[model samples]
Structure formats: C-alpha cells, structure tokens
Target: MTGNPTSRDYNKASVLDVLLSRAPLTRIELIELTGFSKSTVSRAVEELRADGCVVNGGVDEVTGRGRRSTYLDVPGTMGHVVGISFGMRTTCVLVADLRGRELRHVIVPTVDHQEVRNAAEWLVGLMAEASKSAEGPLRQVVVAVPGRVLGGTEIFGPAESMKVFAGPGLQRALADLVNAPVLLDSDANASLLEILTDDATLEDAALFSMSSSLSFASCIDRELLRRRTPAFGDIGVLFSGVGNEVLDGLLSTSGLLRFARGRGLDLERIDDLWLHPHEEVSRADVLDAFTTAMVTAVSAVAVTLDPGSVFFVGRLRPLVDEVLPEVRRRLDKSLATAPEVKAPTQVLGLSVARGAVYACLGMARDRLRDAVLEARRQGQHTEQSAPAF
Candidate 1:
C-alpha cells in the first residue's frame, strides 16, 4: 500500500519553511515552533541535512543547562538566485542566497546597440562573474526590464533604448545560456515588489518609474496586478491635459529634457536641467511645466485606484524633494482623497534588481523543498529494493 503523501513530505516542508523565515534555530525551538514531537523534528532535520538543504550552525551557549543546543539553518551553499535590472542607461545585477542574503552586486553601463542574442551573452557573462562566490549552481534568475512582460517569458513595448529586448527571444536565449529558469517582468513591477518586501502590511499601493520612460505598477490586496496584454502598464501613454502631449512626452526624463531645450536651454544632461542658474527664468518655467504634468498624472492615479500610498522612483527621484510639495498641494486642492506620495529609500536601479530577487525567492524555496522530499523518497525506494541482510 502507498504511504500517505503528506506524512513525511509535509513535515519536511514545514520545517524548511520555518528555517527560511527564521534560521539558526535549535531543535528545541523547532519542536516548539512547529508543535511537532522531538522525533518528528529530528527526522526532518536529518533528511534535510542529508540532502544538503540544511546545515548545522553555531552552538547556543547555555546559562546553567544540561547541554548546548546546535543551531540549524538552511545552507547558503545549497544554491543562489540572480536578479538583473536591464535599464536603458545602466544594468544592475544582484546575486543572493536562498535565504535572501546578497552575495554580489554590480552596476554597469548598458550597451544600447547590442542585439537580443548578444545582449543575452553579455548578461550571462555578468551573471557568471557575479556568482563566483556562490557555492552551488544558479537556481533561478529574474530580469527586470522597462517594458511589458507577457506570461513571464515574453517582452513587449520596451523603451526605445532597450527595444532590442522586446520579444521572447531574449528570455529564451538567457534560459539556454544560464541552464536555469528565467523570468522577465516590468521594472516598475519589480520596484513594487521591493516596496512590498519592506512593508508587508501595505495592501493597495502604486509605483511610478519616472526615468527614461514613464512606467507604472500597482499592488492590490498585496498582489501585483499583472496582465498578458501588450502595453498593459504603460502609463506613459496616458493623455496629459496639455495640448495632445502624453504623460511620457511631458513627465519622463527625456520629455523633461525636450521641454527644457524647447525653452532655449542648452542642457546636455538631466543634472544640468536642475542645476542651471536659479536666476534663469527659462529653467523655472521648465520646472513649472514638469510639476504640473506630475500633479495631473498623480491626481488621476489617486482618484482612480484610491491607493493608500504612491511612490516615485528612478531618475527623477532627486527632483521629488522640490516637486513633491507642489504635487501634494495641487492634489489637496482638487481631490477629496490623495494618496501619500514619496520616494523610495533605495537607489532606483538596485531596487529593481533587489525586487527581482524577492520575486524569485519563493520559486527557489519550492525547488529546494521538492528536491529534499524527492531525495528522501528515492532513499526509501533503494532500501525497499535491497535484499534482506
């Protein structure tokens, strides 16, 4: 007769889940936390250890106890996950262990001219370089792009500079090169993942990436609202109240530069637009237009979603300090309820990569748990098939 599937598998999974959440715990603590008997916890830990999923940590010091307890933890040597933020200006890559501890972080300028295959090769090289310290093979990779992701395998509507990634080819290439599963998602969605990680209580929140392109993502009831449709979250195309200009044409970094140039300001960089002589009337005019467009976009999102909070991220983060007050003031004047608007604490590019890591951690955990259970079952089969001693 077949044994109950949940008998041992469920115990092992529960123990692993606890260690993943709170590691370096003792056997006594595991027994107490899981409400399982000592034998059950011991069996689970032994099986996990045999499968290389768990390892012994330091011994806990005892005050006046009979013995010292050895702490058990999910081993970092089990494997690692990679998070990549492929942006127009720069790409950020982060390597983290199954426990969510960062092992490597790198930021490099993006080559805008590379084709999909070339870009995949270049990124694989970077991933290999970043994961040198990882003791085991790569388990999962999540790539963040400034575009719409369909079914986590295809890319669409990427920004102009990153148009090379707009298709399923890049994801397929990366999966082939890395010999591991790969997932693609919008950079804005990745940012929202990072935010949700910081504060799990947040149910409804929106994020706006005001960089080379204007992108948006939202979390409703603690879940990211993802769609397979093309241009699903491209808030940049929303019509700005100003003379047929879309929000992207007026509020994005490129849009801001174009507006400044139209005002006769010879600005070569975004920094220059903000650092121009305070006495220049044209610079002030550009700021006014930028703030007006921001207020309009934010008010629309606030009224529609009624999110509890709104976040501004990416290249325009520096301008938040100057423009936020006006945004809030204008929203207060027009809307009955305005979401709390602010900038995230982490840098734009790194946050995208970190969020990708958060997005893949669950998958990695599931893979680990299944491997442990399978190893146990195989061992049992081998024993049953052996002749009696």
Candidate 2:
C-alpha cells in the first residue's frame, strides 16, 4: 500500500495472477502456488477482497485437518470484454466476462456498404446489443479483421469487401462509440491467439487460414511474432507455381470459387464445389488444382519456418480433410521432413472471436490491476494528508 503507484506490488499481483489463471484455490493452495508466505498471501487476499477484485468461491468439499479450506476466485463482476471477428460477409461478435466465460455470441451479416462510418455504426450496434447480457461494464474490445493491421489502429491492404475498415477511421470511430480501448489485429493472428490458448505447449507452430483471405500466423518459442507494419504471414502473395497466379488468388475461398466457376463447374458457394454435384471431371480438376496450390503454400511455410505443426483453419477447413492426405503425401514426398498438418478442432469464425476474447480478457485484467493499485495509492495518500485529530 505504501509502495510507488507505478511499480507493481509483486505479492499482491502474483496472488491475483494465480487466482485469475487457476482459481477456485484455497489460501494454502495460493501460498503453495505463488510461493508466498502465509501472512503475505492472507494480506494480499484481504486487500483484493476489500477492493472487490477477488471473491470467496465457497469452501472446498475436501476437508483439511482443522477446517474446510475456502476457495478463492476472481469475481465476474470485475467487467466484461468484447471480441469481434469482422469478416467479409459475416461478422462474429462475442462477449465474455472477466473469467473468460462466454456471455453472448452472435454472427451477423456484414454491412454491404463500403462506408467506414456506416460499418462502425453497425459494429457498435452489435457490440451494444451483445453487451446487454454481460454481468459488468465493458472493459476492452478486440477486433479481428481479414487484412493487414498497422500500428493496431489502421487496416492496410485489405480485401475489397473489407475496405470499409481500412485506415484509422474505423478504429477511432469504434473507440469513440464503445468508450473502451479497441485492438485491431489480423484474423490470422486472432486465430493463432485462440490456438495458443487451447494448447499452451505449442512452441513452434503455424496456422494457415484459407477463408475469405489467405494468410498464416506463426509462433516461435511460444511467442507470436507481430509487426507494427504489415509484413510476413501474407501467404496470399506467394506464387502458386501454376502459371502467373498467387496463393491468394488460388487458395482463398473466393479464389477457389472463381476457379471452379471458370472451369464451368457453375459453383456459386464454396460448399457447392464439394457438396453440390458438378461434372465429375470438372470437379476433379478444380479439386486437383486446389490440392496442388495448397500443397505448394503449406510446403513453403513448412520449409521456410520448419514449424513443428501446421494447422489449417478458415472456411476451407472442410475441404482440407479431403485434400489433407494428398497434401501430406505430396509434402512428405517433396520435403525431407514435413510438419504435422491437420485441421483445427474449432470452427474458424469462433476461433478468431475466442482468440480476440482472450486478448481482451488479458487487457481487462491489466486495467483492473492498475485501477486497484491506483485506488490503494490514493487511499494511502488521503490517510497521510489527513490532519491529526
């Protein structure tokens, strides 16, 4: 309480961190997990409880020697966070509490207008509607976009449908509307964040997204590599080695649809390529082309980064299974060693939103911690400044 406000009270912060990460723990468990002395743990817990940051989660069922140890947890009343996955056609929005529990989730068709203001209004409306179900105030918002994010504020080199989110206008508009800090990141990065959350053991891995956009994100040594300006992970620009076409124009859902249509398959939806019956020869040709392009792209990533695993996500995930065996066979034949290639267990849209929620939850926790520290500092100052009675 007497320490500098700018500096972290390690004991207090450690106690809160553990509770947030692995909660429902008894005081003894907290001391054991944080390696803090009994008195320090008790003091920290008391302060957190006083600040309404931590709450008693009732007593543990298992009885100890003297009394049943009480479980401690971070209260859901801390605040809520919103995660938005802004896609070309459909946008997914998720609201989660401080404990990262989903409160509400909705998928709505994206606005057709190219106006950034209109798009922002649409998104804000969706967020406000979803936030109604939240148990607390909104603390943070993270938006996942299918484009290059520059400086966490602007979208660059976005697809034509996503042009409405380009520049700083959308980010600024959302911040003003939501009254909370907004984080803009590529959908690929958002997917990677979700993957990391699900599997903490992943050190060197790559996620390839073949949805509306063709991009990938990588984790090296358990750290995600991001850039202030757009670079890397733009696999869409890589040549497909099939004439003058890039993977972006060859492997993306849109690109695949275009190719199928051009081949006289009359494919309207991506699902139609596989689900709808087309000329067997034409369908085979299209699938073969897709398989080749995907193999080339995945090989490029595997060979360059040597990632331990490569996960296929996005709209094309369904088709990936059909081509994966062939893709793997080709990769094994082409490279001395090939990383494990498989589809992620979660759906692409949900994965992106969930990942963004994870980021939002982290930011919200930091804000809460800082607020608690500041409040304590102010209380201490008030006590010191009070005239002696």
Relative to the true structure, how large is the alpha-carbon lDDT of every model? 0.81, 0.79
Q: Pick the candidate with the highest lDDT.
A: 1
**Error in Å for residue 327 of model 2:** 0.7
What's every prediction's RMSD, in angstroms? 3.6, 3.5
As a TM-score, model 2 comes out at 0.92
lDDT, candidate 1, 1-389, per-residue tens: 33333566778778887887678899999999999999999987886676566899899887985888899987877778999998889899899988888999889998765678889898888888888888676889999988778889888777677777778989998988986789998888899999999897899999888777788899899899987587677777887776677888876788877877888888888778666554478877777777778887888788778899998888877777688898889888888888888887778679999999988887887776665446445554312332010
In model 2, how large is the Cα lDDT of residue 157? Answer: 69
- TM-score against truth, every candidate: 0.91, 0.92
- Candidate 1 TM-score over all chains jointly: 0.91
Per-prediction tally of clashes: 0, 0
For model 2, the stretches where C-alpha displacement exceeds 4 angstroms are 1-8, 63-66, 370-389
